[model samples]
Target: MKILVSGGTGLLGQGFLRVLREKGEHEVRCLVRRTSPVERLEGLELAYGDAGDAGSMVRALRGTNAFVHVAGVQYTPEVLEAMRRAGLERLVIVSSTSAHSRFEFRSAPRLVNEALLPGSGLRWTVVRPSMIYGSELDHNMHKLLRFLDRSPVFPLFGSGENLWQPVYYEDLARGLYAALTKPGTDGQIYDLPGPRPLTYLDLVRTAADTLDKKARIVRIPAEPVRRALLVAERIGLPMPVSSEQVLRLREDKAYPYEKARRELGYTPRAFKEGIALEAGRLREIGLVR
Candidate 1:
């Protein structure tokens, strides 16, 4: 199979490419922007193009059997039309669980992009995954790891009890590969999440323990953090925390993985186990001791 992958330079996209290469069953070509970092895609065939550029997109999609899109944003109409012109048969788009959540930071735009898939004259599957972790380039759990490593104390937003299911990038990569080859996934939407859910505090505690750190967790009110972040955004200050980040911490992000497990044979590692592996990677990169 000849597959074209957009966002091939992203963490998840890189993971997917690695998986495909390991399998050695398909010819994988990835779309890389001119300004994209190519370090992660050392041995892969890259087609220089932007998704928004119709000519580039068409050029990239030509002669590809299918495409797996892991780009962290929505697909454009021109790209979809280009897929048709290129005679692409199927598409595997990686959306997020954020699209189903109440927060509007990234979800709203994702839904708008998802709305374009159906009746678009192509076989498409939308995989909505939970928090993606593992790997060196992961911003989600790596940020937490950095904070736990550098600070004597970690901040726990709210009661720090809201449930979260973070899927490892490797597991998500397998799921995407399955979605690409699976037969009945056309026009299907599956939640590709982790095997188990952990509380916010427990998640932090696990990260600390994995790194052999004994940092005290400090609980702070969500409202105050949100207000402070809002104020910082209004002014000329930089704040890592956003209102949506504070709000999401208070809500449960757990989702059922039964559909993906049944259809794609998606099996995710336990949260603690996955983080421990990530800790090892961090040590190799000198991100942690």
Candidate 2:
């Protein structure tokens, strides 16, 4: 079997490529931009293109048996068209668990983007991973680790009671590969979360513990922060944090990956263990001082 992967240079996609290489069962091609750090994807076949451009996607997707999309899901229409043109049927899209986000402005798009697919004559499976973390390349946990490394103060936007479950990056990538290879997965939506959920306060403590640093957690009142961010947005002032983000921090992101586990064999490691591994990796890479 041959597979075409987009977003192959990022941490999750790179992890997927590692699995593909280890299995050595299928031929793979990566759709990438010239600006993409193709260095990370060394020794893989490359198709120079961006998913936003329908023509290029069509070109790159030609002759591929399946597609695994790790890029933005908002590009769904373009990729579907390309798949249709290429006569490809299998698709595994790496959507975020934030598709269930409390903010309408955000969640609506994720829901709407993938809704266009039922009648498209495709076997599409969506994997919504929750707060993916594992390596230094990760966005969420990596930033937290770095911030904790530099500063003793870690701010809590809310009461820090809201739950969060961050899946390891490799776990998500492995499940994504499973989604592509497993049968009976057509038109299924899987939520891939960590082994267990922890409170937001516990999250900071866990990261600080793994990094072997004492953290000073300061809880900033959520209402005031939200109002300030809203005012900033209304006045066209650039703010580091947005009202949506603040509000989202108040929402619990705990989800169960039982479906993925039952179907895709996706058994994720605990956040405690995962974060320690990430910290160790950062130290080895000289990212942690």
Candidate 3:
């Protein structure tokens, strides 16, 4: 099979590429931005183009058996249209579990992308996953790990009881590969999550445990946290943590992975095991001792 993976330089994209290449059964091509560094993809076949451009996407889609649409902006419509125009027989879209929530930041983009899939004349499979954990390249978990490493006091908003089901990056890649290869996954939506769910504070503690350290969690009121996040956003401080993120932390983000398990034979590692693996990766990268 010939596969075209968009956002191939991204964390999940990298994992997928690694898996596909190692499998050696599929011819993998990456659709990367023209300006993206190719040094990381030295030996791989790359289709140089911008995902926002339909022509570029179409050209990238040529001779590909499957299209993995992982290149998407949180609130952009261009991505959906680009995927729709790619003219692939099969498409596997990587979406977030936030799509299921009423949260403003994630709801619109997720819905818009999902809504565009129906009449695209492609065998589409959408995987809605919760906060993905694994690498330092990850957005949410990595930011939190960095914060925990740098800050003396870990701050928690809204009682620190928000449930999060963090799906591992490799697990997500496997699920995507399964969907890309499986026949029954077409035109289906699957929720991909980890084996266990933990609260915000508990998750921080787990990170600490992974590092053999204890995190000092300080609970803050939601309003104050929101105001602080507003200030942080205004100052352009590297604030990956946001009020929207904080609000999301308070919701129960767990989903039954049975669908993925049944359909894709998906089996995710426990949160602890994933965290331990991440800890080893951080140590290897000199991000942690």
Highest TM-score model number: 2
Misplaced by over 4 Å in model 2 are none
TM-score for all predictions?
A: 0.94, 0.96, 0.89
Span of ten consecutive residues with least summed lDDT in model 3: 73-82
Indicate which candidate wins on lDDT. 2
lDDT for each candidate structure: 0.85, 0.88, 0.78
Error of 1 at 177 (Å): 0.4
Error of model 2, residue 223, in angstroms: 1.1
* Per-residue lDDT over 13-131 for candidate 2, one digit per residue giving the tens place of the 0 to 100 score: 98899889988989999999989988898898999999899889889988889999988898999999999888899998887888888788868888888787787889999988888
Q: What is the lDDT of residue 179 in candidate 3?
A: 83
Rank all candidate structures by their TM-score, best first, as comma-separated numbers.
2, 1, 3
Better of 1 and 3 by lDDT: 1
Tens-digit lDDT track of model 1 for 1-289: 8998998888898789889989999998889898999777888788998887768878998888888878754665766887888888688888898877777775788888888988788899989889999887799898888888899987677998898999999999999888888889999988888888888888888999999999697878888888888888888697766776787777788898788899988998898999999888888889888
Order by lDDT, highest first: 2, 1, 3
Candidate 1 differs from the real structure by a C-alpha RMSD in angstroms, to one decimal, of 1.7
lDDT of 3 at 223: 76
Better of 1 and 2 by TM-score: 2
Clashing pairs in 1: none
Query: lDDT score, residue 221, model 1?
Result: 87
Better of 1 and 2 by lDDT: 2
